[model samples]
Target: MQVAARGPAALTSGRQRPCRPACAGLWPAPTGLSARCRATAEVEADSAVAGWEEREERGTRFVAGPAFYRPESCAGRDLAVLAAALQRKRTGRLRVLDVMAASGMRGARYLLQADADEVWCNDLAPDAAMHSTMTYNLCTAAAAHAEAANAAPGTDPAAANSHASNASTNGGSSDHSAGSSAAGGGPVAADGPAGAEGAAARRQAAAAWEARARVVRLEGLTRDVCEWDFPPLPPASPDPEAGVKAETIASSGTLGAQPSDEGAGTSQPTSSSPGASAEGRTEERPGPEGSAQAGPGPGSSAGDAAAPVRRVRITHADANRLLTNCFMREDYYDLVDVDSFGSETQFLPAAIDAVRFGGLLYLTSTDGFTSSGKRPERALAAYGCYPRATPWANEQGLRMLIGAAVREAAARGVVLRPVFSLYSYHGPVFRVMLRATSSAEWESRHYGFLGHCFVHGDNYTLGWRSLAGAVCRCDSRGKLRKSEEEPQQAPADASASAVEGSAATEPEPSASPDEVKAPGPSGAPTPTSTPAPTPLVVAGPMWTGPLHDAAELRAMAAEAERRGWTGTGLPKSAEPGGNRAKSSRNSRPLQELLQLLIEEADPRLAPGFISVDDSLSRRLARPPPRDALIEALREEGFAAARCHLESRAIRTNACMEDVLTVAEQRLGIKRRR
Candidate 1:
């Protein structure tokens, strides 16, 4: 092993410095501390290990090496934990893969906080590759020290001191000063050890440091870091039956050979060892030939084996190719996170393929234009669904994205049930988590089309059925009578004539060329149904199923509440000041958003939403407040709740006419048209 020496300039004054306090063993300081102070401490401690600065956020310490790190992403990191927790009930060991791990922060946190058994942090950036390696070394060392300390409860002071002395000698001369300073206030005597108590403390510290160095050695022996470009995915198979086989074949071509260690490799530690500065130093020490590989040391408990391993293999390769290889190997991951820069559509297929049955798949899409209906053609081409320009575009966009993922997975005999979905207006991205399973029947039932009527602001979900001749109530033009099974309600205050006039104003239905015709007894074509003069624009072959699993969401909410994360800006009942006050008290807006989503989720509910303002825009009188509308619906024995999709929207089982009647009576609004 070859180690580099640190210059005097890197050392603090000649006075010895105490061992920086370890927050919970080798893990960085706990979260909630001042970020700046935590960062400074981390830098001071690991300066000898690498050149990059470091920062701690949400209890995870990340080095600001060559990769980009954003403090604002802390909330997203928290959501990742929540997602993992939701999946923990279904799996014993959670294997995670961060396809675009920039600083390895997310992956590291998963290991430390999310009960992950293993994490593969892969990044394409050259700087990230180097920094991730260093991060793994630093974290592993801390873990080893923590384990060693735990394993050895008590020892004779003299023996501990002797152990410390030997550790200091092997660690190189640089660590001597740090150890001595930690022992006492001033410089140590030339010959004798510091006072007995001080000597023992210093020795213990030195032993821990040396243990970290040994771990780095073991890691270097077993793992290899490689830099290789990810190859393009093989062309999609034209035959549905051959799709899986073709994908496997293509993956082999792209990643058949083990990657070579092209970039900076892990060098062996020097004789001077752990005491050497970590900065810009490269060591190359080959492992003993034909020696048995090392694993978690004696200190590791059986329980610790199930926890995330400290060692990691940092690979610099294309994210897509890496995912494809995982699929080809049948190496299914418990959790696969694909946080791409833009649209995640390109990676969704591979991600779905790589996740194990009953596992979780988390995806993020920043391409709002495509999913939000700003770029309809792109949305259709990418998601195989049409995105409508509506007041609830953000929510629609999220569903469209989810619908795309569902379709992609279903094509490969996989069924993905959405567990959680987020349209973070703040982050301006759509994030979703789904549970993967294999059930062709379930997939068929879960995917369908949504037909929306702009004229009456009504929508219907058509599951596994043709959309031909579908007409909204407003477009029936009195040809189709209202179903007798439909509940009838009297208008709150509108005159009978006013109600009749409102119904008459609807445009006449007309026949469309696409309508499917069934022959009558004589084989003559069935009547050509006329299309509504004001047509109901078909919005999707998109996911018309429920956007959330109600039971799962409720369970998640309970977990959040247990963790003291239940505060949402939403009102639980018709309470005043509660919303504003609770919102004010919420330190975690992301959690609040999640809670709000849970409170509003209903699997029986349909997809589209009604914007109270947009619906009553043509009315001459002022529109009813959102809360008032919800309150009125409930009073009338209808189930109504605030919609997470839009601020001014309410979701309810009540018909549009009933909602409007309630609004008119409650707010004194009158339709002008």
Candidate 2:
């Protein structure tokens, strides 16, 4: 509050209290500051409201359904991730069955994002399944809500009745039936009979024992939580006074049609990390603030559930059997993921069989493929696979060792076309991406490892070759000498020709600095020795896993050993001296490398360093020696430079018996339920 003040000019003129002289560029507004402040506030409010409206419209379109209820069953973004991947592949209207659909979040999200012909969410846990069912029901209810909102104030009675009836038919009950009916069609038909029969049998058994065997199937419009016993929605509520008003706003018009975030203010910081330059350089710049909001918690909202689906199924089953059956029946899948929890040595054949002749299969694991320790043939004998040595480089050797299975598939007329392959972030998991198009393209991609390098490109290296004539027969342009072969010529020319041929055929010896003739001080050229060609080790195709038969395994084993292409239990240094010297020369910190592998493969295998205990058993179970640890990691197929430090230290710890206590979890290996 202020009293009425005198004019600034009057004060400055010394008519009242002596005020300091006004500063340059300072001017009072004719209407006063209060009005300006009010105007600014109003404008800000308008902008905020407009932004929110825009977000609401976009979000409404992107996220479908009544997801406010059953957030747990509705949330978890895995479905979105899967859906996005499928969309990129241009797959649509998939028939999906989430066998172990925990709360059905993944399936629900798929429905929201992709146009799925059918989605069947099944879970052994009744409560979780019912909660998921509620999510589906709410989605239908929301559609009805929209329709009711749009109805005119006064409409014809018959028209209204017919509309209502149609809505009822299109409601919850109809949705489920439609899903089931749609699922009954499509590629899913193959698995449906087996799955549905099993489910029905189980249901029958439960009904036989229980006195009350009532099954409550809800309509799409109204959720029957009481009958199904679904989980309750979150208890927290939004602020009533601060609720958002529903109003249309202008779109931000992003190219990808991404929704605008209304709650985010202009002052908020952006969420994306600074992008790297083409050459990987970073350009730093300050950004805005308060842009990102905390995402909804996992298992929280059904809005994520509507979308189309692609065809691919993952299950805990023996790959050998699964693939054989599918193959025998001429049933093929576009792709198969064989990263089981344990050893997949016996399942290679199944993978090959299940995948179409030209389909693709992704195999990952942390055992035989990593090192030479497990004889490729012997390790895969249980399933029947083999490998052939063509040629390979040192680094290429490591990569091939982990990707042995993919290579083996190629050997069996399953063309191993790599689309994308990458080393696992956590451990020795080797991810090999291969495409198998129907039968015609089923051939192995030949990879050669020789000298100190691995060549992945398509070309074979010819072993050391000798030219007919060595010395000066032709110039650098590869010209042939015109000299004719004289049967009766003197031996001198012959000897000279032999020498030249030998010189050309044999690799030129590495020249010492002193041996090189320097150019004259003015402008003469210097003469340098021709460098010797680096030696190369050829590797053929390799079959390391059982391809549905024992005979195949035996063949693979014999071939792997004969060619020295087998995975060594541990990696042996190519250079002189043992593991320790190699570690230093390779710039591979043994401890760090091992640590990183274990963390990626299974961190829980070795938790943390513990003090040596007094127990006799503990004393006897000292950690493996450093050399042994190095050998172990190398055997597992980890790059020498990639193992982490903690793993190495733990391996040699006094109390270390084993690093991987959780042996039950190996990627691509089958595990028990």
Candidate 3:
């Protein structure tokens, strides 16, 4: 009974269906429950979180209510998983901060699939706490169920649970474990187990149930849900004793005093409750010297001492203010993910501030209008760059967003390098992963402006100082034409002479007398001695750096391959029962897209791509195939590759003239005049 992935329409058709058996172990839908009971339970669960539907991806099940569930964002989630995996690979443990948690699906998946040690899922909505807690409960319960099933007849229940836990903790196949048993295709015989296996199973189930009950009790005791604003706390005053107290707390691993209940809504977990024994419950007390001491709360058998307690803290507060607080507190994270609805510019400063040097920041910007050049005024106002609406607008948008982030970090004396940049057409947003560091030697060399000539398909990038005399190769009328006089050969050191030679060799088919203009007071006239100034449209202060770190992308690709996430050689059990085909389809594109990005990621090259067709549409009767032009350019010893920015575009290290010459020769088309 596999449950396939369905769209929003199918989900809201008002038809009630029974929970599939395969999905039962991964969620709270028990096998013994009747169809009506299952439906009722699901409804009750949804009611707790404002009617959000439950969805599964990569074998992790999470609830996504109408308020935060966006189908178009599934690709973003995939990238998040990739980032989490990469971080987990680099660091042994993962601690994630999901600021706008919504249904907490992203955080839950990180915990379940990315091997996250702890996740602080935060959302401003009061019900967010309940939603995240419920998600956690479901996942833990599923793990417990798998543990009971996997236990051998004579195995100790605790030992079996430990073995089952390894599968999830190692970021292996928890979903497959559940599906094998719950889907009714496993080696375990459900009814024939009055023997040792049955007893072990019963013990396992009891332990699982107890764990779930304990979580519920803790929630009731602490009132995990709250509605609050997170404002930046004031800087701490210098205290000579503070350092001593902190050192004592670090050594002991415990808070000196019990958390207050005044604003927190409830008291701490009581010692007298059921399962409150030393092995099951934690206790806190102040040290005799009045310094904070942290250690295992009251719970302590020598065996339990080996197992460290993993703590997860959730707060209802403004994400921006929380980031600011973290910055002020000098608290840093290895990975900071900021997934916002609109522009992420407002939060970039604090986010950058909160990350440790060399840490990663995953940012999402859904403000297409500003980043895509649809509103240049707004783009300049927000990102401090003029985004041009070109055929490769998506690429420009992503670069503009990165440029803004780099500028923001630089102002605070931080250097950021983009490790990966993704522009999803479906979301119409730009997502980038950048690594941050502190460096006083950072200069503005990587920052510059782009000069483009639409008529001749010529473009130039100039540094801040060079921009003063930068000019487009086209004439004033926006056409490239040969000079009537023989151009005098200037000294080899003269750059202006080289520009003139390049332009004079190829001229426009038709020319107007008004095309030529005298040079301005800024510099000497063109080497061709044209009377008129060159026509150029400059756009920049944009990022002229590589959008991805080649080494990092290659590692990610390898990780994807190792996980069988590249849509090839996946185990039958690894597929998420109903949506296997869809999942495979999605993964294929991601793999190809990654390959394309890798090929185009050359930091030494410029940022924008050239549309071969668009450039030669008027000059030639028929434009040559993209591959033909790229091949020709490569043969000429120029670095050339198909660009991911546009379908018929290519990115190359060759100058505009070189590119045009290759295209003209490959297509057997003469340049117009």
Candidate 4:
């Protein structure tokens, strides 16, 4: 059968859901950077401390010693830095809270590279020695960063780091404050000023930037939460910033956990440094116990003028306890980064509340199985979405994550929208940058169910209120069967209009099943009284909105270009999937990746992509070049582009028939049938 000349006009026309969101963005449903530097990473046989290793990434050198650092994950870090830097540029005061700072590398970068006003790095590592190592690396790194914050943009960071190291060692005292930047960055106000960019700028320019970091001892807390005998985070001090500190563990703060088996019903006691002033609103952390300690907190001397005052704090506690303490203290951060190993669903509520309303949340997930449709149980347990395997499971992973955050925020009477969604295949990691808004303008339409038919090649979204009916056409076989042949069922309730008084806003194909004529022997639309019903696989309570916000992508690309972050992020010696043995001939620049992401944001393009090789190339005697085909599709008035999630795939408003016609006519490729 010859494919249809015109694809679904309604899908392409109407410019299809104009969410080219502006910078401030629109909630209509309601709502809502950095690092690309490639510095050769040289690993030190031994760091300053015994048995500790040092490594460099994106031009910043830090202690990689005995901590969880994945060199291949540098691309994600690069993105994180860019995002943090951009947030700082916009918000003026960038204070970051690293929930699980396994080596403090990310936190160090936040201070050194993103210009974070202060960073509180916390890890659950019970190793006192390893904890000391993280503190030292973070403080010294912060010291150098703070000193060079105002130095010419071209200042050599290594020189400043060397100077700070020499100064700290000259004192022969292991007190962390010798070259600390923590003393002068001002108090860690329980409630920080969110939009005081003008004031923050003046403060930054008037005095030297400071980098200070401290790691606390946590021996009482059990390494395993299943034990439950350990202490939980105490309740908040009604007004802690005013100087009345809350008791270390008052036992009143509730754990805002979801139905996750991560860990439960446990807590830990917080201690305060002896003889230190209350000027720094740090969470209570126990200090040294008569010189048996691994290291002491940053210098308590308020008069250290040479150190230029840094403000970073590191601790040994689970993410829940640490963030709960922050929430109790009202010590909200400009950005909260949660880079969990599996999924961050359990931490979403606490992390969301810890942000300073309108701040950023950089959340990550590495559990591909949850969204692979192989384990709908895990998906439901984690993000409340029942995911099933689809050709586009990767994109589903991202959407699943965003939908979780959006629901969490809305439930808390806050609003959240995605700034960007990223998926990398190394660990099959999924990360998203979300901007939280104090203004609540969430529409249920944005979050709903998704359905894909086994027979039909198309995907559809079901609205919250309009759930009963979905209508899908055709098959995934890439050819139209003859009208006289037995017909397959239409997709299950893909189009909500299957029932009366339905309010689903998703548009349908311009042509109806019962058109003026029946399909010829060649592939074409057929006349039928009613569409056939096909088996449908549905997954939802997930985000049904555009994958990305284009306005934000434009800004992020500009930020990446400005930072000269051009490397693909993985080491040139390593393949993108982190295998050094594999050839990396296909590695592209960071800008190229960003550009593809920007293109993927085209609102006219639909949700799932059509795999060229999987869906189309087999049908054509000779498949057309992907780029040329995309160009031709565009010329034919269809919105089409390269899909970033899957290579050799096309994301378009064009239906299967239209695509087949394009291959049959524009490119002069003969169909096999």
Candidate 5:
């Protein structure tokens, strides 16, 4: 109830309670805190909304004090950790940089779970309170890593929590020093004074701020989380202009617009852990033979359990500045994870630039509305392509995001292929893991426009240069209406057989060479009139390729099982049969989701999917059985697979006509009375 009273100031003021504070200084606030934040603040768990507290994920503990952390969205994190671990195995080393690391959870896990050699965790906070909270978590995470590394073989991994407990209870070494800098400071000079003295003061202050940040990086404590070197506030003066100009120092914080969050992911954290489970999981990473090293390079490894210690540095800067600095310095990271609130389009170029050759870029987008065609103009501005509503809009959201990155990389003569793409309903979040590649297809056919025809409930993918003279065959409300001349109607009784016959008899629709030719037969210079237009709700220049890299998904699933995150890492049953196959083994949501995504990678399936409950599927007398329909699809030699974006939907190559036919004959879907 006191949220309005507390606002952003509460977390920044040391004297005030740790009521939820906005990290506004971390980024600029042209308007104010986001609506998603407001709604989340309203319904947050009673334990969390009040302030700093401990939370556990993937066997690592971190504090959630000033930044927002939702347990529901941890599915994305689970996959990332798996990928980072794989990267380490492939390259023999992994260095990570996590930007916007509010609670430092992801970065901490990178060190503990992925066994990275080093991790730079950043949340460049704008105020003292948020900074201190983040510092506490980072220090505790590092210390926990140290203890876990030193713990000998055959010891219970859960016993490792005691070390972090001691660190927090002991006051983290510099609590008083940190508090004094933030809670008690002399009035800062508001405006630049005349001449040399003022200039010298500003330089001294900037130098001191740098020194402070550097120390915090090395030692991980005593950080107050304010702007580096700049005056914390607009100044203790009445000059509004001075305040406005003062913002230039931290301008990188607001480099991009406020991103849309995954509204679905913000549900109150109720259960101990909603989507993640620890059935076969352990907190320990054993070394070769039996003895584990506590440090990397010479000693322990950077993995879950008390494997070893890795170099970890905590930073508080906007994402762009951090990545850009790396780019300029040619100091690239093995993995760069940017978990921004909304569309990650703004950071694509810079993110690509900062990654070492062949490294991965894990991107996210929560603007489900934009991809669903609610904001075409905004989508264009962000992804360099427009989004139009379609039956598979959720999947299009993934394609839209990938297409943008592909193009961005193409501009630099590089290619990126999806290691895996995830669409979690929790936040309606769209996440994609892309890796630089060679021998992968990025030609025009793989990146083109997609069209959905309302007239026939059909979808098409066409190249940008080939849109001319294209026509929808069902323009006349007739299947494959090959000629303009109206034809005789068929009897009602034969319609069923006719419906099922097109799969074998008629060819799929395409630009008719005869109709598309100019008026003269000899290829005249110009044509007098053109064929009638067929309207299509179109979305484009997006990735029309496979959603997941089959090899990568398989490896991740195997890794999940090896790490005890899942039991089999395989679905209990996903057979293309009549009965719905059971999901993954109990308490393994990550495995279940991964299996569904794996199914979506079939090359035979096209760029669209149909909801099992939509009118197309209802064309049968009864709602068709999902597995039976999939089996029917394959029996007729058509491709079919379930899409993870929606539970009851399938992506297949067979046209709707064949689907209805197979439903009628194989699935026992009777014709309507």
Candidate 6:
């Protein structure tokens, strides 16, 4: 289920997979599906979209399909579960948030599929608006696929039935109390005053909102497909006679959504803000009067006027400000996610206050450490959670605190569920998701940890339990685990090997006191001889040659020192008689490395040169020396000359591969070493 690749490969399905992009080459396959179903899942062509949707409607919830975004934290399991939860909880329309909304792909899909009452989407950058637009376009494409599939002979049955059911359900609508303010229709007005100018502004805003909303609805088309129609956004409504104005609807662009029913307009679009620009790239939408109508596309006005409803506005202001000022009021949000990248605990109490009673505060704590060079217990205490270190052998100081917090919350009648988790690529960063209940629990549990820099340049969990506590507590085993575990031992070995191979060379470890050579021989003073200092020797010319430029050479030596190679003996000529000896000593290792590199590349260069392991193998395998690299280098006519230089550098203990790699990097060569 886990995939790790150091390079790219062409799969049997003809997808070019790149190691960096990670998921760039995968085609999601459904489990428990027959051959027919599996074939249906590989519906990459635009033509197959319709058929795929038809099959998807009948597929079980567990069925995995090709996803545009399926990373651990961004998409895949977490997103799927979230979507299903939204659907199950919604009575009429879904209220959703796309937090870290990158390009709005996920939100756009939701708009296209779910019957959302309102959706709010926000991002850290302005360029995200373009992504929002694209997501909306894709959603439209998905919708079209659904419509087309249903229109087909056999696949159409399920869609037709669902449509009929939705229509009937929409017809008998009551007040949707359970949904957010954006969902159930309420007051609809501009935040400004009522006047000629106000009305014009409202109209402009509405027109813009509708325009972007329509773009979100047009998610069915690929970039190649042309749009059909676009509805103009409506204007904002004026304030009441008492000078009270309501909030306007959030932009569909924010969340990249359209009307859920496609036929009805009851759902309020909240995925994105109206200020976003779609750049006019959506499939055609049928206008009110005609089957197909279009204008400047995403910005065009559909030319319709209707009074709007009032709705609670969604904005991206600082949560601390909102909560402290009481602008949004307590119990305003059913679910509030304060996903601060560094620390979410600072806003925990405020978030808990914002959510309604029995609501969920999905908070993330990425700062996992304790004070005084240990894990603190205050994190769990703040959230009404208690630690239970079962199988005590598996418990660490920091982990115990987390477990304790959950247990404490449970004791206080707070249903705590530890959900999805992820570790950063280097394993230094860890993200944990927890669902908390009750304001008291949330307030009490809000805490932070101070990290400790341990020996060997490693960071170990350490923090104070609380203001009252002196230090964090941990068992002897936990301390040993922290200090003794050779977690980085393998990586260090790999690095050593890489260094050795590049030098055509050799390698080491361990030491003894006798080998170390203590000061005295047989407890007697040992005589020493003073050696003459070597003079400097430069490689370049007199005026420009580094040898003559003492100052420059000194500067170079200082620079090398800054990079951890401390010493004053950098210039070969700095020591007169020993200049060549020192240079040879330094250059010899490099030559050895180059030799090793040449040896590694030899099989690829010479057709008849068989690898010793390859020769001994009983099974048939491709020639060991034949490599794509050799072919690529030869195609460019640099193979023979470069190989000769490489071989010489390896044999002479001079640096070759580094130089080659530098040249390749400088030239921006796509080929890998």
Question: Global lDDT of each model?
Answer: 0.46, 0.26, 0.48, 0.52, 0.51, 0.25
Report the Cα lDDT for candidate 4.
Answer: 0.52
Report the C-alpha lDDT of model 4 over 1-673, residue by residue, as the tens digit.
0111232122111111111111111011121211221111111111213323334565554555467777667667776777676554443345688988888878767765565545777777756434544554565555554344334233433334422232211101001112222222321211123223322322222111111111122223222110000011111112221111112111211111111111110011124334432222222222112111222212111122121123455556689866765665454666799999988899999898777554678899998888777888888989999898987888889889999989988897656777678787767888888876554446455677766655545565565443454545443222212212545432223222121101112343332222101112123444465456564566777876677766666666776664555655444444354444332324445677778888888765666777778767667787578888888777655667887777788876555655666777788888777
Kindly list the per-residue Cα lDDT of model 2 for residues 142-183, writing each as its tens digit: 222222223432221112111222221110101110121011
Off by over 4 Å in 2: 1-317, 342-345, 356-359, 372-413, 439-673
Compared with the true structure, what per-residue lDDT tens digits does model 6 show for residues 61-161?
00112223222232121223232233212212233333333433443333333322223333333222232233232333233323433345233211221
Query: What 10-residue stretch in candidate 5 is worst by lDDT?
Result: 171-180
Q: How many clashes does each candidate structure show, in the order listed?
A: 16, 106, 15, 46, 16, 91
Model 5 bad stretches (over 4 Å): 1-50, 153-309, 438-443, 474-534, 567-588, 671-673
Q: What digit string (tens of lDDT, one per residue) describes model 3 on residues 1-673?
A: 1112222121121122322221222233345888998898766533433432323444344434434655445546655666665554333334466777676666656644454434556665654224333334333423433344344322221221123223321222211222112211112212234443433332233223223321111111122211111111111122233234334432432211111111111122223322322211112111111000121111111112111222233445578866775554344554678888788788889888766454568888888877667788888887898877655577777877788888898898667777788776655768888876665434355555655656556555555655655565444321111211333322222222222211211111132212112112212334566654456566777775577866566656655555545432222343323235543322334466668778877543455677767766655556668888877766654566777656677876554655666667665766666
lDDT of 1 by residue, 626-646 (tens): 888788766754556666656
* TM-score on alpha carbons, each prediction: 0.60, 0.30, 0.62, 0.64, 0.62, 0.29
Model 5: lDDT of residue 350: 81
Q: What ranking of all candidate models by lDDT puts the best one first? A: 4, 5, 3, 1, 2, 6
lDDT, candidate 3, at 211: 31
Candidate 3: lDDT over CA atoms? Answer: 0.48
What's the lDDT of the predicted structure labeled candidate 5?
0.51
lDDT of 4 at 113: 59
Highest-TM-score candidate: 4
